[model samples]
Target: MATLKQVARWVPSHWGAGHLVLAGFLALLVLAVSPVIKLDLVVNGLFLGAIIGLGAIGLSLVYGILKFAHIGHGDFMTLGAYFALFLLSDLFPRIGLTGAGLGPFTFGYPLLLALPLAMLAMAVVAIALDLGIYRRLRRRGVNPVVLAMASLGVAIALRGVVQIFWGGGTEQYPRVSKLFYRLPMDVRIPPDNLFVGGLTVVLVVALYLFLTRSKMGKAMRATSDNPDLARVSGINTEHILWWTWAIGGALAATAGVLLAVSQAQLVPIMGWRLLIPLFAAVILGGIGNPFGALVGGLIIGVTSEISTQWLNPSYKPAMAFLVMIIMLLFRPRGLFGAKD
Candidate 1:
């Protein structure tokens, strides 16, 4: 009741009014379809959201801090999964650990062990890209449009490199065929999906705490607020930038591995397809707000699944695009974005 009253008392400014409108929309949606909300839709939406949200965190951070849209971030997702796949395929079994994932997951212990290495590798790759390309451009004082265009070119080159190494055909994890379980409400929950979702929650919580409480995390936020101000205040903006890539790259890698586990297949172009939705999520959540990624991801994910009821399932990918368009139409700053 206290929370309800507090919410009721929120002043309806341009920024706050959007919140109330969004909340009202949700309330009306619940009231209208209280009965037909399928458990599967909820379950699927959650893990899918988890996957997208995890990756979006990285993309959001890069955009917020560096002020450039990283078109190559999605490629990190594909590369990370490939890294895990390379290690876990026959090498793990050769070293004597089989691909029998803990208790029913299609992903195995060896793959889990490979996760950190993939993260580290991806982080190194991110920083290297910064040094190799972005740093030089910034030093030359090029506009952000130039940076964005360069990233798009880099993304295409990266995609081609991945295709050359991993090949175009889809590849599966060391061949695990297990029975996926469905709950009482006709809700099917895969073991790997549950694990990924749980991990995402934990990471998000840790990130929130870190950003709010830790020194470096707060510095990152400060840099995002004003790089010039942060530099004048004794904060090393360059260090913060490097660390941003490290964290974002690590998270992107993990999201990729989790996505592979869920689909039971890996392909070079998989992450490419997921990029549009990720961009949508980042925009919907607001360009620089990490928490908004969580909220936006859930809305986008659940809406994509549930939208199938009204539109064709084949159009599911367009749901994020539609949401982004609507957001741009009304609340251009996004749900959590600070009002100008």
Candidate 2:
């Protein structure tokens, strides 16, 4: 028989017996249902999970590198979607790109192209933001709390700018008529969802590879782990900071574009409302842990969607807060976070 300490060491840090038990319970609950729940809801939940995961990744990167919670991060996502909106509006007519717009391709095709462009645009914007606001503050040696406040101000100001350009009305991407997959119960899956999900997986895997395999990625990890040590080791702190902002901004934009295509709508508050769940995902996954953030996003997305079956649809947003509070009370360091 193994001693408790030995058994503890054998288990994965984030996947102890308790987590296994919870997983088993959830599985049993799903199996016990007489008639299956709505397939649409499950599929939608998965799609939502992917979008939230993308946004959460960005938040995790920023938290890890910048050592502050960026309340304004979601705005970057909104900015990306708006960028796509403008591009689509301009390109569609000229290129005669109609109904998914990739020349006999599905809805996913246009989005596939749009997402990268949006990400690049957002990355540029992030660099600019750093240069304009954060760099100045860093030079002044401002405290992290003050920097957090500055992020909030940036959020509000960006919202104002978006409103001025796009106005307060809701707009949508052109709807694609083709369905990628159809289910047994008359449920339809759009190409956009497939595209979004595929893109999310690719990005997540790529990010993981970059973090683990690339030199810059290692430098970023070093900085996140300990800025003082990184500086002492001659790591270019400024370059790493710029990369963090750029990567975070790009991820946020990608999330925004994905959400827009999935919902087919662009609203100023889209990203703002999403911030709650994004934060919840980040915290639940473990602060400064990208993998944790990914899992957290999925959990939040599924729970929120499932809860809608029991609670009012309007209460879905509150479910994230409830989960966050519970996690904070029980596992303050989050599921994957390192314990002090």
Candidate 3:
């Protein structure tokens, strides 16, 4: 008991006030809501939140490094999904890479095989966009709004190409529905979504480690913090930009695949439709704060998902918008988004 008291005395003093109050408030809310809310809804919300956080991380990174909102980020998601679909549904069959996947998963070896290729493809595409359009604008010192508008044009063109090739219909991976399981809480868990959640956690941890431990990662942070200062310090800003887009594109592509697995189908406009929630997560977490994006995604996703208990199911997206508005009105900097 004396040792415990001594350790407690050594702890930070701020824990006695703001953090404790917030913790107490959260505890009270959880206690109040736990009894009435279904456990299944909570599980579903958390799974969805994981995917949303993954999507927002990429967007946050781009905003941090590029200093502009890419309005067409949704289409990048769509592109990744469709690319994966093509590889799994078409290329894999042609190449005879068909085989069994891990037991209990709905996806066969084809979808598994396509995952990395899809990420690579998307990263290349992101680099191309920077080379072809964004870099030119940056050279001319054009405004960010023009870059945003240019992104919209790219989005339309990309969507049109997808429609022209794959048509405007829905597509999906094969044999996916057999992976659902019922848990102790009477929650119907999709194995794919569970995998998504786990993968997202792994990715986030890996990213955090990279950012903290790797030299290039430190350079990226320095660039994001102050590009001019970083350049003056001999950090190659162009290389940092390349890495930023590559990481963002890969993450976004992986998130697209995760979402596709969860829903069991894909449409061309699916990513576009997801843009609002993604943006909400990004802004809510703070415009360029990756860790904040994860927390924001959880908050937005859970609130949106559990909202079905009272509001119409169609109002889920509206909940995110409402949350963003409230955050803007109160904490414009977001939960952990204070600029360094």
Candidate 4:
């Protein structure tokens, strides 16, 4: 192992120091652009950030624990949305609940009910995918790149299945009139936006508490930090894997549902389109750091939205792409990336 002094010396020489420079630049840029940035855009950006963060958390967790890039994660989001749609539109109607509106929200109680069920269902699917595909590959000692490529195939398969079943058109939950709440700076936000942001905060807090205070959660952290050491310490890495997938899948489902509600529509490719931003957040936040994902998501969302001032709104995703490229070039480890 390297000495403390050597490691300390290495830090300044590596890309780690670049992140500090990047941070300073970002701060300066924000200051320069603050006056032009509208409050409504910021509010919309937060809502977008919540969605991106939610998805990125799961992706980060999976990557952290499993040490592989999961390209199927975005498609999993699509699956979750479709699963909730099935419950709300098909199942609930048969049960005498037409998913009527719940107060000022756009959807109904049935959707709230479907949310957890969809999460559970997605958890099962994630575990099944792991057992069926990823586990087999791991046993064969395939590389992480192979696993990532396999996930690409999985992504393609999932999207195809969705297109076949739901058709290639857009679909949405049962709709009610949306209500907006006005805040200062003449910003108007829908209840769904608040719901998305609030739920994201709750979930992030719950994840933090779980990781810090719970037994299994601690084991997960250990595994993420060093799986071999964790396994040698009598931790059941297998169980950790299961829990990671469960949480990841459930979070993906929640993000999908939230995105569907906020956007008022869902298409098979919606998650695919969002995948770049999600990865950008993960890379920007530090791969495998869930909290980093949250922070990165918010920054990406806000910057992407605010860039509309100068660039076409259609290029929002390009903004995320740009951030990712910059990080890859200057600070590949990201802001909160763990030192090796």
Candidate 5:
């Protein structure tokens, strides 16, 4: 508890206050809605939050280390989803491994196999983008705005590729419906939702362990704190950068897959549409703090879901934007951000 308090002191009071306000608002909202409905919305929001948190972690990591807005990150997520689609529906079928559903689950062995491969492919793609484009720009000492613009171009190209290959229509993973389990509070939830929530927890814990216990993770943290100092201190900054993209890309892939699973459909613009909420999560959490991103994601998700009671469901992204603006007005540094 003492250690936690000391860490809390690093954040500005205004940010903490803003969080309190948000929390109070949410509590009031819960009171306004019926108990059963509120519980349902909150549970669904958590499933959504898990996906957003995974994506936000990657965004935070890239920004922390690379210091540029990765506009193409969302498209990379789209690409990862498509990769899984291809593997699960196309390649595996040919190899006589159908994407059969496991007991009480929508996915089976093929998905389990395709997931890691998709993550690996996405990681490689991220590295290649760095080596082919961003690295060259960095070497030339281009401004961050230019890098951001370049990423925008990459984003366009990636979306185009998806459109060309998959068409502009929606896609879905091969699967069947799973029965919802009734909980103690009469809350019924799908198995896939439980899977997403559990996997997210595991990933977050693994990330925490990696950041605190592993040498490479420590190097990444040092690089994020001060790249020049880390380089001078015998840390291989370039290698750290590569690992950053690799980890970020893998996480993005996982988020994309989970989103597809939860939503049961995919569109070419799925990732692009998600980009706004993702940015909201990142900004609300803190620009470069991964854990902050996770917290921000949950807040945004819950708020968006609860708002549907009064607002149009399509306004979900707007809820995130509104929350972000509100937070910034009180605390631009975000909940866990330290002073510059």
Candidate 6:
């Protein structure tokens, strides 16, 4: 009982309960119409939303810690996916892992080997970006808006660089066929989606644990809340900043890889296009609240997917912007933002 209380205090009560109820209601609705609607839509939406949630969490971290909008975040995601693509195409083949050699692996299986490599590469890139641009600006005492503009420029440059290397054409994941889980009444769920969704949940839970239970994680929280105080309290602000970028970059890369795996396509502009919606999720949840970011991400993902049923799919991204605008107008602190 004592343990449960401690856990409950760490995790938000109303939000968790509310989301569970909402998810339950959604499941019921899907079951009620299971006879009519294809199970693929529900499964696909859930899976895709999970991937979106991953990227959204990274964006939230950047916003929460750095206190600036990172418009280029999606590009970083795209870079991670492209990095994975390069690894698979160039490196994987040379190591006697060619053709059906890779067939033994399924998206359902944990990417034990590839995941860390991808995360490391993305973290390096993120730190490089900070060293090259953001750090310089901070040293010069540049305003946050200037920093935001610089990030936008960096985003565009990164996108162009990706296009130059990978070509402007869409690249597809090789050999991995979509496996479906068959159910009654012709309903099928993609195993890849299930894998991605499950991985996302695990990542989020792990992040929550790290943030609340670990020493460095608490230092990160302290830094985000009050940098001066954290610094004065003997916390190494520089170390925290490095970890923040590293974690954010790694998560962004993970999201990119999962998204590409689920969709089986990688394009340079794909991540850039996702930027707005990702930011919307971050802002909607609360600028600096990781838990809020998770809920906000889930909300954005589900809402975007469901909106396709009622409106044209082309306008789906607009939904994010609309939500952001409304939130800004009504609740500037966001749905679960702290009352600072």
lDDT of 6 by residue, 118-167 (tens): 88999999988998899899889988889899999999998898988989
- State the local distance difference test value for candidate 5: 0.86
Report lDDT per candidate. Answer: 0.82, 0.82, 0.81, 0.89, 0.86, 0.77
Worst ten-residue run, lDDT, model 5? 8-17
Model 1 clash pairs are: none
lDDT per residue for candidate 5 within 1-340, as digits (tens), equals: 5564465556455545356647756785766465635676777787898799899999989988999999888888899999999998889999899956687789887888888999999999999999999999999999999999999999999999989999999899999887788876556788888889988999999999999899999999999988999999999888998999999999999999888888888898988888888888888788888998988888788889878878899999999899988777656767777776
Give the Cα error of residue 57 in candidate 6, in Å: 1.0
Clashing pairs in 5: none
TM-score of each: 0.91, 0.88, 0.90, 0.91, 0.91, 0.86
lDDT of 2 at 301: 82
Order of candidate numbers by TM-score, starting with the best: 4, 5, 1, 3, 2, 6
Record all residue pairs in model 2 with backbone atoms less than 3 Å apart, i.e. clashing: none
Report per-prediction Cα RMSD to one decimal.
5.4, 4.9, 7.1, 4.6, 5.3, 7.1
Candidate 4 versus the native: TM-score? 0.91
Candidate 4 clashing pairs, residues 3+ apart or interchain:
none
Indicate the TM-score of model 5: 0.91
Q: Candidate 1: misplaced stretches above 4 Å?
A: 1-33
Tens-place lDDT digits, model 4, residues 23-81: 65587468545777687887798799889999999999999999998999999999999
2 or 5, greater by lDDT: 5
Error of 6 at 168 (Å): 0.6
Residues 1-340 of candidate 1: C-alpha lDDT, one tens digit per residue: 5564355345444446356548846764684357677757866877898899989988999999999998988888998888877777756778887666577776667777888888898899889999999999999999988998898887788878778877899987775666778777677787788788888998899889989999999999999888999999999898999999998889999999888888888889888888877888888788888888777777777778777767888787788889888777666777777777
Model 1 poorest ten-residue lDDT run: 4-13
